[model samples]
Target: MNLLSDSRCGSEEEVRCLLVLPDINILSHSGVSHTVFWLLGIPGLEDQHMWISIPFFISYVIALLGNSLIIFVILTKQSLHGPMYLFLCMLAGADIVLSTSTVPQMLAVFWVHVAEISLDRCITQLFFNYSTFISESGILLVMAFDRYIAICYPLRYSSILTNSLIGKIGVAIFLRSYGTIIPIILLLKRLTFCKSNILTNATCKYIVLAPVSCDDIRINIWYGFFVLMSTVVLDIVLILHAVFRIPSQDVRHKALNTCGSHVYVIILFYGPGIFTTHTQRFEHHIAPHIHILLSNVCVPIPISEAIKTQALLS
Candidate 1:
């Protein structure tokens, strides 16, 4: 029998689910419930799990310390109070959220072999994971615009991106990031898993979880495409235009020096996601465990805000 769990059910952490695929002649109680999932850490590499966790732990430390230091320095030092640093501060916070939501579960899975996750917690982590990821991208987009104004229109940059304006932009970007996640959550409420609760990825991601649903997920897929189209794609196009429009040789060098780290971080941030997305969409011949491990690669997601923070400060 195939089990299906609803993602709703407030105040309940356990998955009280029903059987799915009624057409397959499976019969069960008809009601709404949740599901529990376990992350199957690199199936064949079970013996090496401890060794694998060493690097994960190290990178987690680097991300935490690096971003925390950036946030601390920016907050304590009034000298570093500017639009660029402020945006870096925002990115740092998002990085902390993203990594925290993801790494602890992974560490648990690796260290103690505890991969069990309640559907509620999974969705909650899913919310933070994706919202932070998208918000980071949006923050970077705004950073690109901030750089554009700073380089292309130096004199007007201050007047245009005032503290008030920057705060508003930050709020707007955050709202936009979170608002986009609602559709996904609502969609999840309607889905029930027909597949085994054992998930391939350590983290509960929409991209990972959506495929296991027993319902028609076309709407979810299309809306996701819409979100990517309106936000990520548009941001990339505008950011590229903004970054490339340098007028003089000195100004060109100045822009590169100032914004190079931001661009590099963006590439590092998006590269693995792109590769994983394409691989998931295009290649099915690869082994499932291999695909799962590769998906976690994330181009090695030690997103060092330190570089960007140092560059902006320097």
Candidate 2:
């Protein structure tokens, strides 16, 4: 028997009444609850799990090694202790966390068919995934600010962005990312999933799971939109502004070269994100497999591109 369907609830009418009713006492007696989410993986590609697993595993390994090496080199080489490299270290760290947040579980789905995830674990994964994305956007904004200082005010760069200030900025980035997510998690905890417990993506993203809730999710949707707009969208605008304000042609060229790498990364990170978010929200005619594939692929692209960017900068 499917755990999602409880027989003690006399009929579909009674179950609907119990689920829809705001009475805690009725819900408690109904015993109809969803403790686990069935991850749908790639909806149309179930037979090719092994084939798909191969490339995903390879990407994860490359992302891990690449980001780890970037962090290691930055920490070990004293010559690279400038503000620019320090922020790069933070970016690499965020990439590692972001890639790890979902890839392992994705691999499990592809290899072992371990698709059922406990609700708590699902929430944890969603939180980490979003927090890392937010933190990376924050790091990119800080890096843009670092470049703006270096090019526009070279004499004051060191004095303005001291090691102490960079450390504080790092802390602030983490706090900003995590602060935005905590409320979402709290809101998620109060949600009741009385519909199908099957999640439509390989990973547990907020928007992916929000529709499954039987309760009103307009607040969740609006708040998530607010977070995305305030964080990544705002950062993109500032980064672009900083990129265009350099005074000297020679200095501007150099600044553009540095900012070019960041721009590439930003595009890679946000392009798919915007596409996925809009597609999920508006393009209901789109296939579930497309959403699953895009959501999974977008996370690692930044890490791989960051590795390339770091190499070019070095």
List TM-score per model, in order. 0.82, 0.85
Per residue, candidate 1 scores C-alpha lDDT tens digits across 1-314 of: 22111232111222222123221222133332337776656655655668877887888888888888988998999988998889888988888888888888888887876777888898898888778877887888888678768778988988999999998999999899889987888888788765556566666767778777766888887787787667666677767666667667787777666666666666677666655655675555766556666556552265655446465655
lDDT of 2: 0.76
lDDT of 2 by residue, 226-307 (tens): 9988998888777777667766788778877776667667767767767777778775677767777776777765543563
**What is candidate 1's local distance difference test score?**
0.71
Question: In model 1, how large is the Cα lDDT of residue 122?
Answer: 89
Clashing pairs in 2: none
**Runs off by more than 4 Å, candidate 1:** 1-34, 245-261, 304-313
How many steric overlaps does candidate 2 have?
Answer: 0
lDDT of each: 0.71, 0.76
TM-score of 2: 0.85
Error (Å) of candidate 2 at residue 52 is 1.8
Best by lDDT: 2
